[model samples]
Target: MTKIAVLGAGSWGTALANTAAENGHDVRLWTHNLNQVEEINQQHTNSKYLPHATLVDTLVATNDMFLAIENVEIVLSVVPTKAVREVAKKLATALEEQAHTVILAHATKGLEQGSYKRISEMIAEEVPEAYRSALVVISGPSHAEDVIKHDLTAVSIGSSDESAAKLLQKALSNETFRAYTNHDLLGSELFAALKNIVAIASGALIGLGYGVNAQAALLTRSLVEMRDLGAAMGAKPETLYELAGIGDLIVTGMSPNSRNYRAGLGLGKGKSLQQVTEEMGMVIEGVNTTKAVYDFSKMYHVDMPITSAVYQVLYENKPLRTAVADLMARPLKSED
Candidate 1:
């Protein structure tokens, strides 16, 4: 059995920790919340996050970063995008001597704000040389809600190091869960991050009472937007055609389980961005990602109309219907 360290006790992090523990790994989850650590260790349930699911008894919890990473073979992080560098820095400090022996992987999906770097890149910058293994990105269509239910799920493990990716596959996969390796780290990470923006669009469309036809149109057009932005950012074209891209977009964009989608739902109902953020009680990653990608696209000279629309609605205070009208009113273009 492998020893795994999971940073962050949020929904996604706890679900993944549960999966690892269920797979017979010695899993230790670290969080800043002392109350949550107590709950996970004593009650075997993260009531706030995964109230419906019972975590395995073997899964442990800690508030101490040192204890979490001690002697672990792999460190898997599912923290929010904003916390990637902070968490990676903490891990580097805590890993000390063990850094060279452990594999570092993150399921966090979002780009950094100023640099617009993928989660893997941010982690690499902060944790460089501290980890001997290439940072691996574990992402795709899976949701923490369904994952805790042991419903069938599949995800892509993207790493430049093939062996590190396979090791993560062995450590995490089971009968109900599977991880496929994709060497296209950029593509896997890109689609995973950008799809949340489209998901927000998806939720907003539904909340605004748009029917399936609108949903269909949004998905198709956003896929084009995602691919175009990815190409300008150096992603492999084939990777965007795979599970990490198309598959992930379908699930997140359509599901109520997505926090980004839920946030958009509130926005579509004419709620203020601040109001929706307060109500959700979780980080809506797409909010920040939309801003980052909007800037990134301008830098790359890519025309990202859908992203721009979402950005306008969220940041510029553009009315939802007005943004929709703007998109529809754009000059006609050939679908090449």
Candidate 2:
């Protein structure tokens, strides 16, 4: 059995740890909170994140980062975007002291602020060269809630190194969970981050009383925006149409379980951004991603009206109805 270390006690981390343990791997789950560590080890439950789910008995938890990463073959970084760099630096130090290199994989989705680097890129930048092996990105339409239920879920693993992608695919694939490998890491990461922005807009539309017809149209246009931006950044055009792209957009935009969608719904219903974030009690990745994409679009000169509209509503205090009107009032143009 392979040794696996999962950094973060969030729903996604816990679920992944459970999956690995069920597959008979030696799994170590790490969290900063000692209480969470106790809960996972003693009760096999992470009540704060996965309220209804019970983790596998063999999956262990630790509050110490060194203990978690000790002698592990794989390290799965599942922390938030804001915390990625710090965790990567720590992991690098830990791995530097180890005798062997470990495979690095991250499931966190979102672009870093200021630098605006993707999660995988940020990890590579922070991790020391000797401690790291092939870096891979694991992302798709699957949600933590569904994954814990052992719902049939499919996700894509992207890496420039084909063997790395294949290794992770073998490690994660099971009867209930499927993993597909792809070479277009850029396209997969871009689509994964940008789709959350569209989901927020989708939730806003639903809150504004727009019907399925409107939602469908908005999603189609959003796909175009995603493709345009990804292509300009050197991603393959067809990759944006794959499971990591359009498939993720559809699921995130339409599902109530999506935090970004729920946050947008709050905004559309006249609540402030602060109110939405406070009520959800979880990181609304789309909120920050909207700002990052807005800045990136300005820098890259990409045309993204819907993303800009969401940005205005979220950041500029533009009334939700006014943002909708602005979007509808755009000069007529042929569909490209």
Candidate 3:
């Protein structure tokens, strides 16, 4: 069995660790909270995140970063986007001190706020050169709640290194879960980050009592927006049509399990962003991603009307209906 270290104790992190353990790997899940570590080790549950689910018996938990990274063959970082740099820096330091090498993979999705770097890029910047060559991105439509239920799920692992991608695919795939490999790291990462923005827009439509026609229109247009932006950012156009792109968009945009969608639902119902965040008690990635993508669109000169609408509603205090009207009122253009 492989030894894997999963950094982060959030819902996604715990779910991934459980999956690895179920695959017969020796898994160590790290969290900042000692209480959570105890809970995972003793009770085999992370009550705060996955309250109703029981973790695998083989899964262990630790608060010590060094202990978690010391001898692992692979490190899967599932922390929120904002925490990526900090956790990666710590992992780099631990790896340096131990003089060990392992494959680096991340399931975290979102761009850095100020720099707009993808999560994988942030890790490559922080980690040493030895580990950078094996970096992989594990992302797709799978949600933590459904994953723990052993529901059928498929996700993509993107890496420049074919062997690294296949290794991760082998480590994670099972009867109920499947993994596919792709070489378009940039496209996969960008799609994963940008899809959250579209999900927020989709949720806003539902919360505003819009009909299915409106939801369908928003999703179709948002897919185009995502494809255009990704292409401008050096990603393959076809990647936007893959699972990491359109597939993720459908699940996050339509499913109630998406935190970003839930946040948008609150906003659509007239609640403030702060209220939605407080009520959900989780990071609404799309809220921050909307801000980032808005800035990126301006910087890249990409036309993203839906992302702009979501950003206006969230940050500019533009009324929801007004934003929708603005989107619909844009000058007529070809659908190409």
Model 1 lowest lDDT segment of ten: 93-102
Could you give candidate 3's per-residue lDDT for residues 1-336 as a string of tens digits? 888899999999999889989999889999999999999999999988887999998899999999998788889999999999999999999998898899999998899988888988899899988755498998899999999999999999999999989988988999999999999999999989888988888888888999779888988998888888887889988778878988898899889899888888888899998898999998888888889999989999998889988888888999998999889999998899
Residue 1 in model 2: lDDT: 80
Off by over 4 Å in 1: 97-100
**Candidate 2's residue-wise lDDT over 240-271, tens digit each?**
77778887888899998899989888877878
Q: Which residue pairs in candidate 3 have backbone atoms (N, alpha carbon, C) closer than 3 angstroms, thus clashing?
A: none
Question: Candidate 1: lDDT over CA atoms?
Answer: 0.89
Candidate 2 wrong stretches, greater than 4 Å: none
Selected candidate, larger lDDT, 1 vs 2: 1
Per-candidate TM-score against the hidden true structure: 0.97, 0.97, 0.98
Clashes of each: 0, 0, 0
- Residue 294 miss distance in model 2 (angstroms): 0.9
Q: TM-score of predicted model 2?
A: 0.97
Ranking by TM-score: 3, 2, 1
All candidates: CA RMSD (Å):
1.2, 1.1, 1.0
